[model samples]
Target chain A: MALQAGKGLLLKADPIAAAFREEVKLGLSKTSRRPRLVGILATSSAPSKFYAEFTRKQCEDLGVEFILKKTGAADTGDLGEGEGVEEAIIEANEDANIDGIMVYYPIFGVQQDHYLQQVVSPYKDVEGLHFKFHYNLYHNIRFIEPQSLLTSTVPSAASAGVVESEEPPPGTVKSIIPCTPLAIVKCLEHVGVYNKILPYGDRAYGRTITVINRSEVVGRPLAALLANDGARVFSVDIDSIQEYTKRPQGGADTSQRRYHPRHVVHPSNASLQECLAISDVVVSAVPTASYKVKTAWLKDGCVCVNVAADKNFESDVRDKASMYIPAVGKVTILMLLRNLLRLQQYKAVN
Target chain B: MALQAGKGLLLKADPIAAAFREEVKLGLSKTSRRPRLVGILATSSAPSKFYAEFTRKQCEDLGVEFILKKTGAADTGDLGEGEGVEEAIIEANEDANIDGIMVYYPIFGVQQDHYLQQVVSPYKDVEGLHFKFHYNLYHNIRFIEPQSLLTSTVPSAASAGVVESEEPPPGTVKSIIPCTPLAIVKCLEHVGVYNKILPYGDRAYGRTITVINRSEVVGRPLAALLANDGARVFSVDIDSIQEYTKRPQGGADTSQRRYHPRHVVHPSNASLQECLAISDVVVSAVPTASYKVKTAWLKDGCVCVNVAADKNFESDVRDKASMYIPAVGKVTILMLLRNLLRLQQYKAVN
Candidate 1:
């Protein structure tokens, strides 16, 4: 089991999970109708099945109904061949009973994302990957202060009557923050990592979090989320990990730098010695392949989130840190269910 | 002058600007109707006028007509008080000759983003912040390869009929990357920094670029852009600069740490002694107030982008680095024109 490696510090999320369930139950009762979620799985791939099944369990346990819409047809979203998926999306979009719609990502062997986004209405886009939803996320127009970017200091941007507005600082846009990252953050908070990091005893403020992968599903979104939440994110990937170590090159010119002399990345052997040395948290998404990392490199009791297929950390590394395994994956599902239920209630009232 | 700092290194955007004009000219000639752009200056703010005029000059220089629509309305998008703006958008959308529509951002003293997004047609959205353009950027669906995120792990994500597809790696989803960051990148590349850092002399593949502010407009977007382009981004603001300076805490635990133990920020005097010590590029967005940064902290020739209003660097600091000033901010205007022209051609062809 993924949790087996975390001798005792793995942070059994039972209490947080229970509280989320209670909140979802309360929200479900407040809704006008039963909050239903339709998860469309267009592939029977093992990973897809595993994730789909996990979602089903999380939803069922939270009193939300989950319907698995499976398709054997090899309809790719790229070739515009997702007729079945599109029809299903249209049906769900119009379904009054359905509060949210989540299409399992990476419809394996095919690409139907375009069709899915087109068919699924923004109102039901719980995944928030649709461009319509991104509008709210980007929030195009932001109020500039009297002293922000372009101001009255220069002869350039100081003439047409610009003034300051009372709008408070827009810290970060949360609409673009995806679920998996949110889940990891929630788990970290639940485990008291924020208490250690932030003065307010909440929010991941001023902490150094390292995202060891750059994938669309997890690393990319997580990095964005952490950076917005007032934490500095150091993102290192397989193609670019070697460049991140911040080697101590004292007054050294480019030609005389201490590292990467030949510019070749030794993937499995590349040492993130400096990165781990400073990181308060390490979220590793590199899967299966054993990476040469030592627990001593990280600060004591550092939070580790391993979102890989076979777990990104070795047993020795996992045992020393607090870890969230995406394969175990209960916390993120719980989080999504809680959000969906709350969104349903909001929809019902307004 | 901002260009004075980089006597030998200040990259002139003349060639890039000329190429962009040629592209726009070609696009305009290919279309049945002449390509025109509407510039909506809903405020008389000096900063807004300055930006609007700069854009007008660029457009006129490129043989494109620019019309400035001035309004001093205190309308809120959420309140639906932007009727005049909506009408103008409707007119622009219907006008086939108007190939692009540019709305000067932050109509000072009004909250009208929702109104603009709902009214402006996506085809005319030259800013690419519109949800329609973002769809191509977010690209809702992705194909799961047998490799990539995880591989060959049983009982993981392996059941729901998943299979591999032959799609090449998505080069980069660029619509979300705003113009300022792109301009900063172009400036850096033009200054020969990529050649200094990246292998094969192309792009910010593996360089450490520090963004000094966390605003929604510049710093946030720049960090995301740099990270996506494979650079190590260390973000710092006045409030958070102290936490970033890694002072080599050797099991210092909590008390013996070098800084942030008291959780108080020395805003005016806090030196980023450690951050600049390692950064290859420092994008400073803090305005008016000069930071207490020292020349000795940085290695020779660290690129600095002083986006601050009155300049954040001193003569001593500026003397050692290549800098870009918003006063001679032709790169961003050039980038936007390039995007608009390409978008125009794509719309015309499609």
Candidate 2:
């Protein structure tokens, strides 16, 4: 068990801990003179508990103060049957002591409709779901958010426009690419992966990337990012991929496989074989009760990432995976801390 | 031949042209009384030719003007002798007619030593390579280098300090995350690829990610971005990997392969077997003269991206890959254009 735990730590815990420490130190150093207050507004016991412990450890190490205000879960039946959580959130917005606040709530529930636009002080709205925060992000305004992914997308999209054209915007805030996808790119960097045969520092250009999903939150932003980074991206909506693949093949054959301009498939109509057959990397964002992808469906030596939570896949298949990132696992916590620190820094400087 | 040409266009030309037009229109509409003037400063004719035709088509469509000024290839003797291209760039910098300037030179050959800081006007430095531009990026003061891998690491580091400690410097600007990696996260967002499935307007929260890299330019910034998005992240570096392998034993289970974490190899000593055996997604940045990965080395259904620009690998392993992103392809130009537009927008607002 100790060995397994050690292995787990090696595989998971240590990196997160190290990142947390590094971020905390940096966060604290940036605000060396001011007493910074971080407020976490959470309704669920789980997230609040995690934040309390994690923040406590981080604060203790960095000599920073962290406050957690538990507002209880979103009240599902307050305003017009299911608007209680929004009201509670609005109340929290008025709190004077909070510097940054994140209201933790499930992605779906009875309260989603009413709670989507709940008011929170922009400065205090650390989670970045507020209209003001999104507006700032979409418009590339300098502001604070709990996570970089939310705020970064606007900049990332804007920058995508730049790399694709000769004339980029002047004084435009460079796009802030999404964090999760950025993490994957970071993984490649850490591993020293570069364009084949290029010397160090040589830019990687002209790469072709096929994205399986097209969500505004993830797929669209990622496409913009890849496009910006000089990679040719083919974005296939999970719902409309077949239309792409039905087209005739085109382009030079750089690899073993011929270039298929339209290789995407719609999951609703796609056969498992077609969905998993041709991809070099398969990133699945679908939320399914069980594994939507199987080992048999995968190609050899392919890279796969299931960004969904829940132990939805088969363990045998997972064991054969090249890499696996579990939802809310140890690694995820460290990433969150690092982002939080960066957000604080942005708020301080801007 | 026409079919091949069409395929080539599908593979490269069309997307780039499309991206160029979209970016120019989007970038110009956001700013400038007249059509924005984009100046191309190049030593080589490659980018000049591409941009001339690409931007011209877009300009004609939008009634914008695209300018090309060539310095000719810098004297190899001067470049080899360590004289920088600063002098040549100064001409473009001082050009009154130039609204935005992109200095395209080989990464090698020319001495960059402070040349990035010396020649290009910050306003005209649409590529965002200047120190001031980088500083602005770190502080979130300006968004210029949209697709460069360095964007995410710098800003995230600063923001982390602010978010965790709530005491960022009064006027410090946060770092910007890298563009390409962040794109993946954005892609996921567009597809609603989350465990909790938050509504479109609801605050996005309680998510976590694991980053697998540590490159200063790519990994560090990306981690920071994830944290900013309110997702917990676990970051793993190459130094920490341990390698082990398992084989069938005792014939008890023919179908099951033996597993061992003990055989995990450090990233430095990574063999093809060790690296691909355990990873879920492989974002290869290894600069190689040939394809470093083989079908046999990869696990079934691995997602692999060859970010290297070298045409080093064999073209027969498509069956093993789920997706592949080539290096230095058409997408980069799009990203550059988008970044320029974003920068312009930022300037307009601020």
| Top candidate, metric TM-score | 1
Q: Residue-wise lDDT of candidate 1 within A219-291, one digit each (tens)?
A: 6556655543445557676644422222222355645433321111111233576777777788887754676
Model 1, runs deviating above 4 Å: A1-8, A12-15, A74-83, A108-119, A131-177, A196-202, A241-271, A287-296, A319-328, B1-62, B65-350
Off by over 4 Å in 2: A1-20, A33-64, A72-97, A107-160, A163-181, A191-227, A230-238, A242-249, A252-272, A318-320, A327-335, B1-350
TM-score of chain B of each: 0.66, 0.54
Candidate 1 DockQ category?
A: incorrect
Cα lDDT for residue B156, model 2?
Answer: 28
Query: TM-scores for all candidates?
Result: 0.45, 0.37
* Candidate 2 Cα deviation (angstroms), residue B250: 73
lDDT of each: 0.53, 0.40
